[model samples]
Target: MGKRDREILKNICIESVAAEGNALAHVNGKTLFVPLCVPGDIVNVQVTHKKKNYMEGYMLELVTPSPMRLAPFCSHFGDCGGCRWQPIPYDKQLEFKQQQVVDQLTRIGKLDLPVIAPIMASENTVRYRNKLEFTFSNSRWVPFEALRQEAGAREVPPSPAPKAGHQSAPESAPLPVSGSAPATQLPALGFHVRGRFDKVLDIETCHLQEEPSNAIRLAVRDYAIDKGLSFFDLRQQTGFLRTLMIRITLTGEVMVVVVFAHDNPEAGEDDAARKALLDYLQHTFPQITSLHYIINTKRNDSLGDQEVIHYAGKPYIVETMEDLEFRIGPKSFYQ
Candidate 1:
């Protein structure tokens, strides 16, 4: 084994934050790994293991701090795992991410690269995500204890109606129910917790996505649950609904695709269900221009082999940025 392969703890000053949100520091003839650290942070790290040309370590303590550090927005910041740099200021995070990209090109790519250009800032840092996917899990990861209290109130006994003598509280119409159960909460739509697919974290609002995207996500989940659709089990890979995909254009056009694991050639396609989903989406969100449905019998997450058998409108959506216009289909990659 090479000398660098031996594990050794060391104190090092962090130079900058890396792309995956780990702090970067070079020890005496070794590399170190520190989590939740940013640039200009002087820390003491304990080496966990040694690699051929580098070392892996955990942050033991911080000696100096970076001015760019800021409080993370999400309550599940370190635990939930969807975002890595939420604690760092957005502008500073962008700078660090860009620097990491440039460093990879120069140091790892071994190319005589030119001076890196400034990073292009996203138009809407909040509510900018065009796509999101959520799963139906038996258990949920509630960020705080207060969320449980709110959920319990929905199930508890109702308060008495206002007395006849007192001015009656403004009467509110009852919420429509699908099938037998009331609608599920909206913020409950979210990604799986880090390292735990069976456990889902309920995100009340995500700043990354557009507003309509959240509405569509909640609606689809409600529809599927009402129809008694089964959510996919990642471990067993057996279920009716495997994944939900949403595509949106810069011009506000929306397309939704729901993937199923099994195909019912005999049952054929359910036109009514398709129409209901499409109609609900169109009526609720007029910005949608197209919608599609895909079925995949494969046991894995790869969507390459999936067949898109149905489409509601145009097969693709167009996005415009500056003078460039790009055509995006169900399988197109985002810029």
Candidate 2:
């Protein structure tokens, strides 16, 4: 009925970090899953979802940081959407990963499972990934904290707000929190946020992909913004750039696929913008041995049924397996 009577859970201590990177807690005997936090982290969670057996929420405020929590290595830690377990210790990550597997096999199954071995740590944490696909979005997601702040400010005497999905606000809107700035209407070039297919987080300095990945991504975004290139909008399903797919082999060969939303060469300056983007890529990234482009007007940014065009490089890169050579095209699924 009023702001003071609102049932926002405050000072909720996270009990344990789940396998899927969500911190698990219980409120009134119902499971509550929270993101961007670790076990022992005391936070005020704003419930975004409520169901019979469980609830989902975003961390409203960090009342206290977990003692096991370490400083996130990546600058885009919480915002960019991936690497949610960054605050947790490495050992904990491995433990949870193993436990997740054992969970489905042992706890949730009927089989008598064997003793599960510890997860072997990867020698490389950052810059270890060989392939990564990035999406281009015209709008960016507004975090829950800001959304809640905006909702509070816009409260019309608290007449029972409808579902969050019902409100017709663009993904990026003017929602300012006490400490953070308002979300922008600028375009985004990054990985899709988990469960939010229409939203992209605009990744900066992704630690997953190795060198030249982050560089190329940032370069593409900057050049596109500077050149007035159009980013693909999921809602309207229009624009020039759709998605970027980059694949690198250990043998030093790299393949890049530039997916355009639609191909309109005869249209005014569309061809020029396409050519300019390609020229910049060719001139900038000399290390790209295999470069290609695709014209995909499909509703989704998926590579399904799309024709790949080899623009300025080999049709396929060669990968040797002992005595045989394997051909890897721009659309290859080796990885």
Among these predicted structures, which one has the highest TM-score? Answer: 2
TM-score of each: 0.67, 0.81
**Pairs that clash in candidate 1:** 127-207, 127-209, 129-208, 129-209
Write down the worst ten-residue block by lDDT for model 1. Answer: 172-181
lDDT per residue for candidate 1 within 5-99, as digits (tens), equals: 33334347887676556777887776666667777776666565667767766554555567766766765565455777765777887787787
> Can you tell me which runs of candidate 2 are displaced by over 4 Å?
1-6, 140-184, 318-327
Model 1 misplacement above 4 A: 1-14, 26-30, 41-65, 133-189, 192-200, 265-283, 323-326
Q: Note the Cα lDDT for every prediction shown.
A: 0.62, 0.75
lDDT of 2 by residue, 87-139 (tens): 88888888877877787887778679877778889877777666789999877
